[model samples]
Target: MTGKIYIIGLGPGPAGWLTPEASAALEKVTDLIGYFTYVDRIPPRDGLTIHGSDNRVELDRSRHALQLACEGKIVGVVSGGDPGVFAMAAAVLEALEHGPQEWRALDIEVLPGISAMQAAAARLGAPLGGDFCAISLSDNLKPWSLIERRLQAASDGDFVLALYNPASKARPKQIFDAFALLRKLRPAQTPVAFARAVGRPDERIVLTTLGEADPGVADMSTLVMIGATTTHLIERPEGRPFVLTPRSYEANR
Candidate 1:
C-alpha cells in the first residue's frame, strides 16, 4: 500500500475560508508539511506530525513530502492561499518529474482553495471582475528584469493588476519601482487597492490612486491591486466604500 500526498491550499489566512475539500484532506493526512507559518495554521491534532521548514526550501519540502508518502504515511503539503498560485503545487510537480522515479507512482492530488487575489478582489468588490493578471514581485526564482518587463507590459495594456509578494524585508524597492513605472504609464486617479492580512482578524484595506499611493504602506502580507481605467468607487458615508470594474465594455468600443 502506497500512501498518497495531498497538496492543500488553506485559503487566505482564515479558517472560515478553507474549502470543505481541503478540510477533508487535512483530516486524512498523517503528516502536515509546509513553511513554518503555514504549518502553524493547522490546529494541533492527535496522530499528526508537523514538519516545518524555511521559506527558501520548497523543493526540499516537496521531496520530503513525497518520501513520506512513499513510506505509506498519508502526507499533506500545505500552502496558504491557493497552492497553484505562486505557491507549492508547481514546485511539487517539478520535483516529482525530476526526482527519484518512485515518486511518479505515488498518488498526488492538488486541492484548490481561495487565492489571495480572489480574496482581495472579493473584499474590493471586483477590481478583477474583467480581464486581469497577477504578477509576483519577488525575483527569487525569476529575474528582476523579467518582473519589470511584465509590470511595464501590464501597465501598457491597462490590464487590472493583482500584485503578489509586493514587499518583503529584502525586496522592498521592487514595489516602489513598480509604482513608479505604473504611475508614468497610468493616470493619476487610477484606483489602487492595498489589502493586508485579508480574511484574518488584522485585515485592513487602503484605496488610493496611482500617483498618490505609497509603497511604504505595503508589506509581504499585502496584495496590491491596480484597477483598470474603467474601474471606479462607490462611496458610502457609514461603511467602507465599494470599488468595482463595471462589466460593460461600451467605453472601449
Candidate 2:
C-alpha cells in the first residue's frame, strides 16, 4: 500500500515560482524531505513531517524519504534549483536502483525547477546564448581528473561553461585547478561571471575577466560562468551589465 513519491523542485527560492503542480504536490505530501536549507523553502503546512539533513547525507536522507513513501506516507523529495540538473532527482533514482528490494517498487515522478544556471544566465543577460555545458568542481562524486578533462574539452570547443559546486570546505583547490586548466586552453583575458546566493536576498553578481578573477572567492553556493572564445562584455552608458555569446558566426566575428 505504498504511496507514490514526488520529487519536487523548489526552484531558486521564491514560492511564487513554484509551479501549481509542485505546490499541489507539496500540499498533499505528508512528509517533506530535502537538504536542510532547501526544505526551509516550502511554505508552512500542517500534517507534514519535515526531514532535513546535512549536505553529505543527501543520498541517505533521500532513501529514507522514499521508504516513507513506500510505507504509505505521501512524500516529497525536494531540491533547490532543478531536481533534474545535478540535483536530487538523479540521486533519488540512483538510490532506488541500487537500494534494497522494496525501493524498486515505489512510484517516483521527477518535477523540474528553475535551475541556478538558468537564473544566473538570465541575470547576466544571456552568456549561455550559444553552445554550452555544465561541470561541477566537487570531487565528492566525480574525480577531479575527470572534471579537468571535461573542462578542457569544453574550453577547447569554445563552449560557454556553467560551473556548479565550484567550491567546498574539503575541496577548496578544485576551483583553482579548474581555473588553471581553463587558463591554459583559453585566453587569460577571457570573461567570467559569478552569481552568489542567486535568487536569494543575499545574492550578488560579479563580472570580470579571467586575469582579474579569483577562484578563491567562490563557495559552495556560488555559480561560475566562463565565456567561450566568442563571448564578450558589452558596456552600456547606464552602467548596466551584460554578457553575450553569439549564435551565428557573423555575429561572433
Question: Among these predicted structures, which one has the highest lDDT?
Answer: 1
TM-score of 1: 0.96
Q: Against the true structure, what is each candidate's TM-score?
A: 0.96, 0.96
Write down the lDDT that model 1 would get.
0.90
Candidate 2 lDDT, 94-199, residue by residue in tens: 8888888888888888888888888888888878888999987788887778998898889778889999999988889888988888888888878898888777
- Candidate 1 lDDT tens digits, 169-232: 9888989988988888888998999999899988999988888899989998999999888888
Cα distance off (Å), candidate 1, residue 57: 1.3
The global C-alpha lDDT for each of the candidates, from Candidate 1 onward, is: 0.90, 0.85
Best candidate (score: TM-score) = 1
At residue 76, candidate 1 shows an lDDT of 97
Residue-pair clashes per prediction, in order, are 0, 0
Candidate 2's displacement at residue 85, Å, is 1.0
Clashing pairs in 2: none
